[model samples]
Target: MALFLLAFFRRYLLLVLSFLCQVYVLLIRGTPIVVQVMFIYFALPLLANIRIDGLTAAIFTLMINSGAYISEIVRGALQSVPKGLKEAGEAMGLPFYKILRHIIGPVAFRRMIPAMGNQCIISLKDSSLFIVIGVAELTRQGQEIIANNFRSVEIWGAVAVIYLILTGLIALTLKLIEHRMRIV
Candidate 1:
């Protein structure tokens, strides 16, 4: 969410602030978050003397990875706002920031709902990848339970249902938001 706000700030308020953001997005999107997590958790200690635990590394790596994608979604949505409204806002003696806050932000955010909501679901699914780093996430727990009880059918079924519920909630919530934001 903060990254989404920063994306808007960079696009309209301060161009220079966006350079580093763009590089961060490029680097994160260029590589798999798994590899990024591995680098942070393992390579960083050997090369830069920065060592974080698996969970911390995984969380931060996922955050940066997701932030990069979310920023793009936000930027695209913000850019889709019409140029005329900005000019009008300027004619009304409004600063760019105020125009964005009162005008562009709401419209862009409404447009952002569908894409951003999909990203939320993607983030949830992607978190399962952290199991490779020994995060003991839902999938890992399912694996452990199956190994112990040989109930793969039931355990996996339950896990699948839980994930479905989560993604469903995200979709439903976003739909509600979109409905509420309708220009009444």
Candidate 2:
């Protein structure tokens, strides 16, 4: 089915995008995320005569930002996959794409799940930085609540708890996948 094919190639496409994101990371990692958000939200409007909404800008910035780190994780996992597996796939007369799909990708992906999970958690936390650009994510929402109710301690604490819950869920999901993919 078309859906299965799409799912199958998603990783490869993500891998390529992740590589590009890695390059972005190498360039911007030293800069603060606040600066990055400001550049997209403030500088772009002034320089390019463009205006993008907070949520869209935040998602774009975070995707590329997180992509950079995720890409490095992906590259390492790809490299860690055993070379013998590729040879075995080829020996079975599998084509390059087939070999990658059936062997290289699955093996590398399973090994990379933990790192990927780490990246996801990092990304979710980084979403808080979007508050600088006025996006209404959890952090921004908390800020608004505090601004209205003057309950900085309680609201911010609740926001932190929400992020912890989200990250914990991500960790559990990755653990399940890692268990399912264990080599035995």
Candidate 3:
């Protein structure tokens, strides 16, 4: 959702909105995810005078962080759609929206698949950073078990295997989608 909104803003919205989107992308991409998680989990409540739980803060932080990167993925994918396609659509008397819907969108969507897959995996791993704010995610759970049982090697190995399996599944799913959507 954020990716679509930011891409739309950058592509078709007012100049100010486009500029703001760029600034947002720059800020988010430049900062560390850990700091973003900490700031959202700790500093935001103080600044906004609203209370939020660690889980809520963690979700919001990951959303904002991943949205910034995914917006860039979206932008790049859209731009990668060949200029000839748009020109051909115009040559056929198609409107901008129809051109995008029928020609550009599908091609760009296919291009986006791999990068989106990578971003999904990165976001999954990054969620472990929420441990700083006491979100009891998989990594945090593993750490807790290790602390209790003194089985660091086994616990951490299991956590690593779980993450690997999850990421592998994501990659396989995306690859299948990309194969089906191939432009052949």
Question: What number of clashing residue pairs does each candidate have, in the order they appear?
Answer: 0, 2, 0
Indicate the residue-level lDDT of 166 in model 3: 98
TM-score of each: 0.93, 0.80, 0.97
Model 2 spans > 4 angstroms off: 1-25
Candidate RMSDs in Å, in order, are 1.6, 4.9, 1.0
- What lDDT is reached at residue 23 by model 3? 98
lDDT of 2: 0.76
C-alpha lDDT (0 to 100) for residue 39 of candidate 3: 87
Runs off by more than 4 Å, candidate 1:
13-16
Tens-place lDDT per residue, model 3, 1-184, is 6679799788778999999999999999999988998888778889999999989989999999999999999989889989999999999999999998899999999999999999999999999989999999999999999989999999999999999999999999999999999967
Worst 10 residues of 1 by lDDT: 6-15
Q: Return the TM-score for candidate 3, rounded to 2 decimals.
A: 0.97
What is the alpha-carbon lDDT of model 3 when measured against the actual structure? 0.93
lDDT values for all models: 0.88, 0.76, 0.93
Give the TM-score (vs. native) of candidate 2. Answer: 0.80
**Candidate 2: residue 2 Cα off by (Å):** 18
Candidate 2 per-residue lDDT over residues 17-79, each given as its tens digit: 545544555776667777777788778888989888888788877765665566566667767
